[model samples]
Target: MIELNQVSAIQQQTQVFNQVSLKIGYNERVAILGPNGAGKSTLLKLINREIYPVERAGSYLKLFGNETVNLWALRSKIGFVSQDMQEDYTPYTSALDVVTSGFFGSMGTHAHLQPSDDQVALARTLMKQLCMDIDEQRMFQRLSTGQKRRLLLARARVHHPQALILDEPTSGLDMGASLGLLSLMRNFCGEGRAMIITTHHIDEIIPEIDRVILINQGQLIDDGPKNEILTSEKLSDLYQTSLQVSQNDGWYRCWHG
Candidate 1:
């Protein structure tokens, strides 16, 4: 389980979130929604330990029911896929090498400890599962934006972490690519894994999502089951705009006047 008790985060002298509290139990798939500048990305950074909360604010961030688990040890168990994948790719690395690099937490390009043949096979399998057919030997820098995002996410899962954190995983994807990514995410939800995805759009919410967390202006606005928190009235109130929300099959759509 992941728990945040009265947690606050500050970066560059700016308060990102204030006194936010949330709990995510095992096997829960959560979608985080908010308007622009709501600190959604910052919150994901907090979970990944990219930044720490201010000590004077009496904030606490805990993972897996423990107060003091070694963060490095904990990191190996969490898969993080962020929107910022432009900086890590190299012009010369092959696709297979890129995926293999994820086994040791490298950014899909850098040289690290060699992964085993079984790991290589798994990487290829994941690529096939995602409907991607790029040459395994193709240069990393040559793939399209959508391909990069999918490859990066597949890299994160090479270790099969206990939890997954995805920040705007489909931000730049087209319709086909987005569906492929969402399908892959749904396949990850099971009896023992946990996932927290930060996204602002309705289409990004997977059908397997069990909960929703809403934030605005760096404060947690709502946190509850997806069925209860994603209503038209609640979302309109949260975004401070008149919006129509509808459910089709198991997904949601937002209609604007």
Candidate 2:
């Protein structure tokens, strides 16, 4: 679903990601895990075309099949969500309006933008599929974090994307909210779309993700099956600290000694 060939990205005179050669197929579920400053977010931006890679001979970034896909077209195929996206939302925007904005890939529905009957129907259907139970007219800021997250997911998938990319899907949530988010993520996964989530918590790499990619200091460090890449020593090295990895019911998490 994604191909990066010797890709390097620099922003504001600082190199955030470099030489990240990787290929992910259309159906494989994957996670990109690294500590803060590991260039995980930069990589996602590159894939999502929110940022550009450094120009160099033989450097390329392609989604699905072609490098020429328009950003709008690219977005329709891949749904992206992140903490910053949540913060960018208009506090007074209603849940339905938020989802409606997804039709145009805008931050939130604005006065200039109007939703058609079909668009409203699809948005409501998506909200239902994601199990969003909030009153459609409730303002985004008034909703709980978990509810907001679900609304964002509904917004992201309003166009029915072929893949989903999440950055820190469970950040700023308690155990209950985190699990609730996970359950929604699993439902999204059940729709048979490719999923790539970048996270600091091992438990966020839900069972649906079969592959894991490790990044650090703006470089792609490791790429392989989740089980092989998520070992105690590897987790320790990835975080730059000594740690022990634990697993229960196919979920993984780590703790420092």
| Candidate closest to the true structure, highest TM-score | 2
Can you write out model 2's per-residue Cα lDDT over 133-243, one digit (the tens) per residue? 569999999988888888888888877889989999998878888998898888888888889999878888999898999988987788899889999999888887898
Candidate 1 residues lying further than 4 Å off, grouped into runs, are 69-72, 86-88, 110-112, 190-192
Query: For residues 77-166, could you state the per-residue lDDT of candidate 1 as single tens digits?
Result: 888888764455665778788777777766645544777889989999878776666788977788887788777777777777888899
Q: What is the C-alpha RMSD of each candidate to the true structure, in Å?
A: 2.0, 1.3
Error of 2 at 240 (Å): 2.1
Q: Alpha carbon lDDT of residue 212, candidate 2? A: 94
Clash pairs of candidate 2? 1-24, 1-25
